[model samples]
Target: MFVKVVVVFLVMVGAALAFPHAPVQQPYYEQQPLMPYEFGFGVQDKYSGQNFGQRERSDGRAVVGSYSVDLPDGRRQTVNYKADKYQGFVADVSYTGQAHHPYH
Candidate 1:
């Protein structure tokens, strides 16, 4: 009970310190991660939106694979799907302006 309370307090404190300059703008959209094996595919964050999902079961001792998000504008962002989230192999994400249609 005491540990839980302390943990919660610390989390709140950390969040406050971390996002001290967070945009006051309210998020216009929200998305949840996909379940294992179930994939959610769509033009991720295209035109004006956010796209986020997880390739099911691409973790653990399993031979990791690669994944990509091709926006509506001919831009393919590939990322290695590795064991564990965040701590796994990942290329620092980069941004690119749409040059062509992703529908291609």
Candidate 2:
């Protein structure tokens, strides 16, 4: 019983030292850009209405992405963009207010 207690104590100490005291929060958006390859998609944040999903072409000649962010005035803004060798770049933005709904 004494030996078991000592072993448990040692294990606990080892774990405490091996793991981080505060968990590291690396959002998916930040991680995607750091990868070796540039083609991927992820949602970086949700609560604040911030997220991005993007991808690059295999030939490296084009990229397409979309992102959304919440405004301070209780409105949400979204943007969609595309870039290619033929066309430099094009983007479209739309704003939606929480208080206004045309369909409803």
Candidate 3:
């Protein structure tokens, strides 16, 4: 029993070592830049106390942008998006106005 266990352990270790692990590389969006079309905006309110902004770009290969706004109740909302030749568009949204739900 002891010998069999030792053999199995050694085999597992050998197999793991034989298959060398490779480091993961950055995603295409992170490495490549979207150019040829780029624009951005910013706005602020000193009297009413509100702000909003957006930035967008595309190069026929990829599109990326970010938008943010201030809510009337003093909450902020932001959304980010990215689209590339390889992987389509991906968006991430965050805001304080979102409804809360209890987890089951």
Predictions in order: lDDT? 0.56, 0.68, 0.85
* Structural similarity to truth (TM-score) of each candidate: 0.26, 0.41, 0.50
Pairs in steric clash, model 2: none
In candidate 1, stretches whose alpha carbon ends up further than 4 angstroms from where it belongs are 1-63, 84-104
lDDT of 1 by residue, 1-104 (tens): 99999999999999989886756874453234434453445445566666644343532333344456646565656665555444766444543556675556
TM-score, candidate 3, is 0.50
Off by over 4 Å in 2: 1-59, 99-104
> Candidate 2's error at 20, in angstroms?
63
Candidate 2 to truth, TM: 0.41
Clash number for candidate 2: 0
Write one digit per residue (lDDT tens) for candidate 3, span 1-104.
99999999999999999998998999987786645798999999899676999999887687889999987656678999998868888999998764444242
By TM-score: ranked, best first: 3, 2, 1
Best by TM-score: 3
Q: What tens-digit string does per-residue lDDT give for candidate 2 at 17-93?
A: 99978879798765553323355565766575555455444334456666666565667687878876588888999
Clashes of each: 5, 0, 0
Which window of 10 residues has the lowest lDDT sum in candidate 3?
Answer: 95-104
